[model samples]
Target chain A: MMEVSPTLPAWVAIVTSILVLLGAALTLIGTIGLVRLNNFYSRVHPPTLGTTLGIGCVLLASMLYFSVVKQRLVVHEVLIAIFVTITTPVTLMLLVSAALRRDWAIGDPSVPVPPGLPEEAERPEPLPESDQPTS
Target chain B: MSVLTRRVLPYPLLSAFLLIMWLLLNQSLSAGHLILGSIIGVAGGLAISSLQIPSGQVRNLHLLVQFAFIVLYDIIRSNIAVTRIVLTPGRVAKSGFLYVKLDIRNEYALAILACVVTSTPGTVWVNFDSAKGELLLHVLDLVDEDEWTDLIKNRYERLLKEIFE
Candidate 1:
């Protein structure tokens, strides 16, 4: 088994440290946005920020640090980036759609539901076929 | 060939991206890894065939690069600004949410926009009304809703339109 070196080059350490701090700071801002922003829709942006670029930067730093310290290419971080990029949209879309559906149900004037509900929602049950099958 | 090329890999670029990503994360050029990664990539390509995601052909790659640079700079600047506000002893009043209309409609493009907005410091993508194309965003320091709106529409949206439209 190979072990990662305990110490990193001065430049590598400095760069990684700076990146980590930058990532952390960005994450903090996202959270602040989460807290400070008003309304449900308005609040959606911050966490996406934290999860996307915030995670992207942090993951990049990790990849760099491990690659350097371990003397081997370390790159699993991209999986996270991929996952975050792909899933954020789906989760956000679901949440937004859900919120919209609730608003529509409550008759909130602001929300506009699709002709019948957005494609995702379960449709109204069709009337049971008349007892006799039509010829 | 066209079916696989156009329909299966609707976004050859994105599929290529996934391939490179698999290699990077696995951190090996071993034949085993390459074969496995290729299988996964092909499977993924096939899976997206059902999504019917609209593909945007990027014309000016240069502008897209410029947009990336701008986002990087803004993230750094906002991070510093937000940190100051959070660490300050006195509770500085900072609260604001603004609704901005969006012009882009591609689901993939919108997803990218959401990621960009959320990833940046001091901003969040709270909600978007798909039917009306209105987005509600919360800014940590709401000194100016107009400024926030301008930043998003002019700064981000313009670049995104150039890249994806």
Candidate 2:
């Protein structure tokens, strides 16, 4: 197993350890929320926690560890942070919109009925038995 | 002067950002790196210019910085709140959709607001109707509808309006 160098300062090691543990804990909590949330909309909220702060904490730890041990200013981890921060929202918006569309299509009354569609037409009745098994 | 600058660098801010990003990615501050990064930045700016994307002028840099700090603070606070919500096993969270009527009309500002809202945990930007200037957001632990509305309007929209409008 790899070990921290004895020459390295204790505080750096301590901070890194704390950051890693906090990040892992937050990620665990996020996954637990994903599993425990009752509905799909609620479930969507938890994963953002892991993606935002969870990865943020872990990346900060890595950055600190590498910069301290290498004795240099290492900040390339910020690239990942920036990329993740920007991309996560785009993907999440796409997913939420898709889910909303699916809900609308299925005529789930819980979701607001989209404009121009009557309440009865929200969920179109199933086709006759003759057209059922075309595949 | 304006015409020359527009012809050479259509998107000055984007060019600057690209240059900074290049230098950061290269992890160097040498003369050669600066020249190369500038070249890439110029090329990127010109390429984007060819797309003819509509650009909104940012009127206030101070407000932009202030808004960024507010977003960072909110993200941290929400992270804690969400962590607590997730850890408490039996506590039920009230998640619901909210419609916010927006007065800010700038597209760039609206896009940034959406990104900020969606990126923060406990809130998801679900949809927007451009015609009505209305945004649909989902909140994980909604307590008061008025509070959320005020939060979005006063906290973000006001600042965004100052910067972009």
lDDT of 1 by residue, B56-103 (tens): 677788987897789778866775666565555565536655689999
Clashing pairs in 2: none
Regions of candidate 1 where Cα sits further than 4 Å from its true position: A1-8, A14-61, A85-135, B1-4
lDDT of 2 by residue, B79-126 (tens): 999988988869989889999999988889988998899989999998
C-alpha lDDT of residue A75 in model 2: 87
After best superposition, candidate 2 residue A133: deviation in angstroms? 22
Give a tens-digit lDDT track for model 1, residues A1-135.
954455768888788878888778767876876676445554565565567557877898898988887788887887887787667766765675576555555544444443344536654443355422221
Each model's backbone clash number: 13, 0
In DockQ, how does model 2 score against the reference complex? 0.62
lDDT of 2 by residue, A1-135 (tens): 988878788898999999999889888888999988888889888988888889999999999999888888888888889899889999999998887666666545577655445536647554555533221
Residue B51: error of model 2 in Å? 1.4
